[model samples]
Target: MIEFRRNIVAGTAVLVVAAVSGCAPGTGDRAQPATTATGTSMVTSPTAVPGTLVYLDVAAGRPITMTTVTDGAARRTTFGTATRSDEHVLVPSPDATRLAAVESPDPDSVAPGDLVVISAGGARHTVATKVMWGGGSAPVWMPDGQHVIAAVGGQWRVIDVANGAATPYPAGPRPGADGGYLTWSTNGHWRAIGGSTDVTVTAADGTGEVKRSVASLPECREAAGCPTSVQAVSDDGRYVALGHMNSDPSRVTEAHLVLDMRTGGLVNLPPTAPGGSVDRVFFRPDGGMVVRTVTNDGRYTFVLLRADGSTLATLPDTTQQHPSGRNLVTYRP
Candidate 1:
């Protein structure tokens, strides 16, 4: 299995606690400001916004929660019992109605485990397998939403969510082939595979690859935290989000970065509010990006941003009691 480090930092400015999913509900684009508990304002609507943002609430029984833009309301739903913090949870389907996750009956083992598929109304299907689970390397949903792509014993496999059927998937390389972490876009057309020093953007079929060595950048050489893995990829494979790690091991700092595959340039999102840092960035299916921000006091907030880096809305706060305080599982938009 390809081991991965899941603790990568994401950052951006301002605050709005809301999720992004599906199409805009109303006929016209409306501008509304929702004040968060922190007294910050978030833009709730602007030009066909992606409504519905889903994420995992770890401290709360590890249940999956969905927050919508229209009312800034969140509804919590549990698929199954809680798994370890390291285990994957609530990887949403392409349609955002179903979710894919990994679980182990034997909780202490670090090896691969069974794949679980959870649909709407609390219905679930579990398929026994040895698929490795971790951040950015979790089971990925193909565009069809019925089948899932997973990494098994190092290579990729196409699994039928309806049944336990599986087949070898060679669209991407095996673990030892490049020693890089692998993450695929939901569209199944692009893959971002790389490590702390560099990242490679390529077609799903393994053609037209472009690699940039981040180790050569000033952030890797002179900054406190260096990127450790690729967190999320835009649907078109044009924008890539990176996670950073510091050498001190005692201090954690996240550098909010997005790589423009088209220009080979690195773009940083707006700065975060005082003592807050970006934790994760998930690209919405329709457009824009969902930025997960973390405060020093263990509060979590989700902000929806347009492609131009403007705030669409900010989801409300979700807190984690654990020392790690990283409760976000996945954001399905």
Candidate 2:
């Protein structure tokens, strides 16, 4: 249920993106021109933000698509068609060329399933395992990109994607001081663990010592059983993001919380106007952040943020109807 990121020494506050009513300057509410192209379009003119935005349409069983932005133009490339669903939690490899998916055949039950590894050319290799759900439970691709670390039936195992081989991984999913699973930085140098009350950021070295612990927002602390997950970690390890993932239309919970690891400051991110919650957060290699927000009606918007958590631009609506934008899973910068 908790969400996922990595480490830094000396902490400050956090950063998150939200759609505020009375949007003020530096509130990070600035919206960019939307990208409306849909279907199997090979290329688009450009997106407001420059980077590769990947979307997996699990409902359609379409190939995984990657939209790369350079200068201004945006071009898309697709991997081979593979069986994916909302029941699957997809995590890209460290090199961004492959993906590790936790696939559950039954959508209603959180049971164990096959760990599908999709190669750059779209070939899939399935490794049977009990890895269920996303966040910390999603398979973690090690720095080598060949082996993945996943928690299997309470014990952690290092899985080999090439063949269905696995070995014990004692240094398993490192939990934060508050017991939440740790999310690591892009470089694997930093790891962050967040909970309902506080978030702890630490270096990834053998020390495993708590370097900085910052308080969560008042809203998070007030809500009972307020779920928290270390979603994204800035590559520089200075900022960490905590978010909630509520797809149900009835529940409009707190959107997100961002902590500045250097200063321990928190960005004020309220929920969207129409029962929208921050579903996911991805940090660009340049320190920028991409936030995925979902509304009560099942609409999704991808927003780009500066290093300081200020709004930079927004992508097109990634609803289920759009073939190209459907199931906006994650982004790679």
Candidate 3:
């Protein structure tokens, strides 16, 4: 029997209120303008543009919520429950109508875990694979919403929604290596995997085309300042965000690098060391902006930025309620 322990933070009661109110120390009252820790004010979007943003909330345990931000308000919609002890919710389609999520019933459970799907209205479907146990990782949905790609066991497999069948795809070498972190191109034509060596991109349909590769420090596990064991690919698939850190892991920062997949050119974005390293990078529906999270002592602060690496605004941390749960983000353009 494998039990997963959720870490709960103590003290800092005032910090909790400040986080939820989107006011981080010295930011004055909630009615005042939002600012970063450096006291830089941010512009708040008055209304959530209709069909413009999808907010990911892993506040709930097994069941997660996907909220649509429009007209400046949040409308949360409940998705299907997960089967994996450690699961991640993914939205790969551009229309925000389909979702892919990984599910492992037990930590010690073996092979053939499940890849579940949820339609826009929340219809559930499970795609079973031969990759048994080892636990499934993040799922990337294809643009058509009929297929999804995930790393099961040590191999990456693409599952078809119509038949709930999975086909193995070349996930770049190592069998047990952590190719778990994956993201789909906004068009859903390509999928990128981050693991032992460089980040590798491939076609989602098993077309066997090597799109491009962006090398990171060899041996990610052994890298000196690599803060994160996970990485995220932008929705457009033109950028990859890597979390850098010191030896302690607690002291971390983010390195956002824009990848010109067509030319194999990599440009590093301005470093944003927001207390903790950026845990996740998500593209807004407009494709012109992104949202990232930085965490410290189990607390998270969300930042909205432009593709050019400009800080737009900072969203209040909502992870206080579910300190142990992963924060999910999505957009509904």
**lDDT score at residue 97, model 1, on the 0-100 scale:** 71
Report lDDT (CA) for all predictions: 0.55, 0.53, 0.44
Per-prediction TM-score to the true structure, in the order listed? 0.66, 0.62, 0.57
Each model's number of backbone clashes? 13, 26, 16
Q: Which prediction has the highest TM-score against the true structure?
A: 1
TM-score of 3: 0.57
Better of 2 and 3 by TM-score: 2
Per-residue lDDT of model 3, residues 26-78, tens digit only: 12221222343211222444222223455554432456566655535656666
Error of 3 at 195 (Å): 3.5
**Compared with the true structure, what per-residue lDDT tens digits does model 1 show for residues 1-333?**
000011111332222211122211111232333243211222346332244544444433554443323234455555554456224344667666777877655544445677878765556687647766543456666667878877666666788898878887644343332233556675566677655677776666665566777776676775553574665676656567876642321112232677755445565554677998887777754446777777777666666775446666775443333354334444444
What TM-score would you give candidate 1 relative to the actual structure?
0.66
